[model samples]
Target: MKGKYVEAKERLRGSIAPLVTPFKRNYEIDLDKQRELIEFQITNGTHGISVTGTSGEPSSLTVDERITVMENAVKTIDGRVPFVPGTGSVNQAETLHLTKVAQEMGADAAMVIVPYYNKPNQQALYNHFKTVADSVDLPIIVYNIPGRTGVNLEVNTLARLVEDCPNIIGVKESNKDFEHVNRVLLYCGRDFLLYSGIELLCYPMLAIGGAGSISATANVEPKKVAEMHNAWESGNLEKAQNLHFELMKLNDVLFKDTNPAPVKAALGMMGKIEPVLRPPMGLPSKEVLKEIHQTLIEYGKDVQNTFDM
Candidate 1:
């Protein structure tokens, strides 16, 4: 039962990109531009990329776009990097459909968030994840972000799912709870991978044996995030800590508003893509964008200092 879990954990143990969806001026999917972003992340050293996550503005995308992106991601990467697609929906039926689509699209795994809006109870949450895990042949990474989802994936529920749903391998622990994260790791022992979903908590999560990050920041600065993961692998504790702290401020800036807005703005500042987030997610406010530009450059300044060392 734990064999697949172990393999999936290893598959995710690196700087996985929570990829940003590039849109045209009129706000349509730009497949060619998205391909370029994939090439950029891969060439610069990102280990994996996950589509339809919060950073990808999941809610902003239509189901058709989600399918298209999933297909495009696998086809664009063409096996150069690992792929994980988000398969969470308020209903289990939709979740199953997406998970099956992800498997069909050749994703290595699917990141399933707890049911949002409806706020399911503990048992309901367990069933939702277990049903998906059992339905799909691909591995699953539980995405626990109470902040966005309005519910939590409690430790007990997680432990039970891992025990029962063999393919439910690990979690993108988003609450920044090292204590809870460590407990899950210890409970499942070697069977579970603890993926840091919060960019600011990457180092601390790694300190407690977290495998790596499903990081939003990695979309903008793939090289730096990869280097920090490499430093951790090499046992260079000080370097990893300094790099983590250095990026924390920028992380706050990006999340200050609804996700992907500030990050898309920063990427625009870096000239990676347009700052256009779809209507409901509209552009970050002028003042927020100004602060984002300043904070991110500060992160860049720190990166330069580290390189100059």
Candidate 2:
């Protein structure tokens, strides 16, 4: 491996928090809050930082908005940690453009998700990823979230992309199917970097040789999340496993509604961010909010006293 790719592979592991694109109540992009969130993640010991991924609501943001988030993240992170920005969209041109922007801005890696909504076939999937990978010099982490994309990235297809594009170094498996994730490392080789995107599988994936996670749960509990990875890597399996089971409820509640909504609400109750989500992605229901509030209290987060009943 080249020196740069080798360094990225080493540094990009662990709890890479897929950040929420914080918005004001009026639905404006809150860059200032975004920076604050970045600082929060860093201070709390997050291993790396990723923005504009599933948790960040990429579909809702304009191309320019995505670019702006990448620029902001690059500036704020400032070499403190590895930065991997979500640079994929359903449109090929947009994906290429955003990825190029990320590389130009000096991101450590670019996570290109499977083109959603189109439901492209394996060959098409291979082609789409290879083209994007070929377009940039940065390491590319193929994001396979079949649930949202309506198309699964077969292991063979991913293997082919890895073979074809040298820069395509790893995959972020947001998939729930453990078998599929197993096959990816099996076929792609144990050296292939697999980062878990599923909150529940974060530790298990590590046990199975995954590099780390880009978990949404990290948005609420960066310290513990990063600690889970840190513990496992440090050979403290018992501690890591305990944290894994400990985080299960938080993981469950955060996803009780669509992502970012529940996570945003949790952050809001904690007074970290405003807890506002964009249109078509509102705050969690009163019922879910109450559950989240109670969950936070149990988890020892200082949830605000003003939580509505």
Candidate 3:
């Protein structure tokens, strides 16, 4: 388990794009568009592909739909780079089942988010991860997004989980508290892979020895995001910092409304995917759409030609 953790720690470092699950106008999962999106990421230099993540709209997806996405992603990725899928759900059985399926389907790792709605205490959080980690041979990257989950997985609790679960090798730190990221690294040892799930913190986290980031901004700007990481890794701090600032607005725009909406709109304008979203999640507001249009145009996207409005 320790060896597997170390191997994954070494390989899973860089800009991992948490891909959006493309939906048709009728809201069916567009598997063909999903493949095209994956190819775009790979062609543009993304180091990894994380499907069915927060940006992928996992909560609204049925278990079978989620599995289908994972299967298609693995098949499409085809060993080009690492494939990590979001497998966690509010239900433990579902989480375990998805993780097992990810393993069976040849995923490089599985991202299990903290259970939402239930808001488990720190001990329960630890136990929840422990049970999943124990059940699977695949490396587990704990997804700690307290904003969505309603409870923060504290540094002490996280370090404890690492100490106890050898297969629990990394974390996607999505909270706004930068101190939490530093504390996790300080306590868990630098070898424990830490990825910034917050776009604005991506470069800063890497500067502090984080493995990499899973940026929703990458959905539209994979090259720029990959270049930021590549620049930093190559020790071009000036170039990396410049790219970070360049991407700052797009990151902000993505969450101006709820996630994936703005991003999906951006992709729609770029002709990468249709701007459709599932029920309970809708398109960006008119004001946000205008902002997205203008931003993409400024970013060199041909919004005038491609976006139908």
Candidate 4:
């Protein structure tokens, strides 16, 4: 466990791409395309890979499918970078099962999201994460995205978990409230890792002692996203700030619809993957597509010949 902690502490920094799950037009999970996406991140300078995250549509996948995604990611990454898979679910049993699988599969850590829809209170959230943390030897990163989860794991609760659970190492904060990030850092100590799950907040978070980001924007502009982190780490704040502004439009466009949809469309336009989405998650409207197309073009992506404008 100490070795796992040390390894994760060292490697789980910088622009970790929360990869979107690629699907065929028939809507099957595309393992081949998944490998291609992982390779794309590795070749383009992303520091790490986070599979089956919010962008990967884990809610849409079965347990077996989610495990397969993690397996494929671990195999494809092949020690070139750290692999942290989202092994969380609304069901605690399922979360435990998936997280255990990730630990066995050589994942660097397990990202367990706050249980959604049920809106469990802080104590329940603490017990919930504590159970999972104790059940696995891997480092645990608590994922708090209250917008989607319908419950915010407060700073005090997180501080309690950190004190009680040795393996609960960090957090992926997706909330818009920057104060929550500050409070978590203040309470947990500065070395406690915080990765921004919000694209727009990535640079700002990094500026405030955040470890890195699990940015969806990295799906399109891996090099630029990674360079922003590298620039900041190397003390080039002006370059980092410029890249932050440069990425703002693309970041906004990615969330224009319901995420992954616009991001998938952008990837499709670039000929990287098919823009297929699962049921209940459809592609963006034509207007949104046009905006996405133009945004990609403005970012210097080769989308001029791809979409019918």
Measured over all alpha carbons after superposition, the RMSD of each candidate to the real structure, in angstroms, is 4.3, 1.0, 1.2, 1.2
- Model 2 misses residue 255 by how many Å? 0.6
The 10-residue segment with the lowest total lDDT in model 1: 300-309
The per-residue C-alpha lDDT of model 4 at residue 267 equals 95
Alpha-carbon shift of residue 285 in model 4 (angstroms): 0.9
The TM-score values for the models, in the order shown, are 0.93, 0.98, 0.98, 0.98
Position 275, candidate 1: lDDT: 65
Instruction: Mark the regions of model 2 whose C-alpha exceeds 4 Å error after superposition.
Output: 305-307
User: Per-residue error at 98 for model 1, in Å?
Assistant: 0.8
lDDT of 1 at 71: 90
Give the per-residue lDDT of model 2 (tens digit) for 1-309: 577887777778899999999988788899999999999999999999999999999999999999998999999999999999999999999999999999999999999999999999999999899889888889999999999999999999998888788788899998999999999999998988999999999999999999999999999999999999999999999999999999999999999998889999999999988877788888878999999999999999998744566
Per-candidate Cα lDDT values, in order, are 0.82, 0.92, 0.92, 0.92
Per-residue error at 113 for model 3, in Å?
A: 0.2
Candidate 4 residue lDDT tens string, 1-309: 377686677778999899999999898999999999999999999999998889999999999999989999999999998888999999999999999999999898999999999999888998999999999888999999999999999999999998888888899999899998999999997888999989999999997899999989999999999999999999999999999999999999989998789999999998999888998999888888999898888888887334564
Q: What is the lDDT of candidate 3?
A: 0.92
